[model samples]
Target: MIDSDGFRPNVGIILANPQGEVLWARRIGQDAWQFPQGGINDRESPEEALFRELGEEVGLSINDVKIIACTRGWLRYRLPRRMVRQHSHPVCVGQKQKWFLLEMLCPDDRVCMDRTSSPEFDGWQWVSYWYPLGQVVSFKRDVYRKALRELAPRLLPMQEPASKHRKEQQVSRRRRQERPEC
Candidate 1:
């Protein structure tokens, strides 16, 4: 919902695995990618909106994950002028999000991108926790970095003797090489 200040009240999701890899999703019919997020409804609380978004965007249920942490305040970002909606009642300028970090408790196969009739993501892959910090659209990078850094300590990456990030990258590269050109 768009707030009185012109910013939309939204919920952002960072779904990470035990290995500290985050789920990166591809927008349907587009090459761009980002974390799963949705606007919080006027009738719903941020937490309630979070669960609905988790299901609608990532095809996840509240029972499938454990909430590790959440932003105490809204983290905001502005939309580039060209992207702003001029005709809307309350000109929405950007989003103010309540970010959430969740760890998947179920097995990897539990992710169902097609769970919704109109899915938010058509493709998804697990990547390093820091991977998307620079990869998301420029406008949202700062907020993304803030969310990841704030939640990193809780995941305790320093405590792990090894990170599977390298392995995941290698597999991705190999698959890319094996695929035939269109």
Candidate 2:
């Protein structure tokens, strides 16, 4: 629900594979990709909303994922001027999200886009932990970056230096491939 600040209460999911790659999904009929997220219902707690959204968006239940950590407080971002709906009740201009970091404990086959009648994503893939920070929509990039940075240490143990370095290098390679050569 929209709050007095003109921001909606929402939960953002950063579902990661054991190797630390985060889940990225393509919106139905759209090329844009993002992490799983949804608005919280008035009666649902952030944690409750997270699990519900996870199941609806990615077909995962509590049994399939382990909640690693969550943000201490809400992290918010404003919609661009053109996106704000001036006529809407509560005048929501953006989202104030409680971000969750979840580890996928089940097999990949467990993820299904059509788990619910209205699917949030059409297709999904696992990407480097830092990839979403730069790849998500510009309006949400700052929040995504902040969320990932804050949760990384918890997801990646300090002893896994070599693995972390490899992941970063892989992410760099993928970014280069996504760009056109000048």
Residues 30-130, candidate 1, lDDT per residue (tens digit)? 99999999998878988898899988888789999877778778899999999998998889999999888888988988888888788878999999888
Report the alpha-carbon TM-score of model 2 versus the true structure.
0.85
User: Best-fitting candidate, measured by lDDT?
Assistant: 2
Error of 2 at 17 (Å): 0.9
Task: Give the residue spans of candidate 2 off by over 4 A.
Answer: 159-182
Tens digit per residue, CA lDDT, model 2, 1-182? 78988889999999989788889999999999999999999899998999999989999898998777788889999999999888877788899999998889999999998988778789999998888777789999989988987777667664345656777766654553342221
Candidate 1 CA-lDDT value: 0.84
The best candidate in terms of TM-score = 2
Instruction: Give the TM-scores of the predictions, in the order they appear.
Output: 0.84, 0.85
Quote the positional error of residue 155 for candidate 1 in Å.
1.1
Q: Model 2: which ten-residue window has the lowest total lDDT? A: 173-182
Clash count for each candidate, listed in order shown: 0, 0
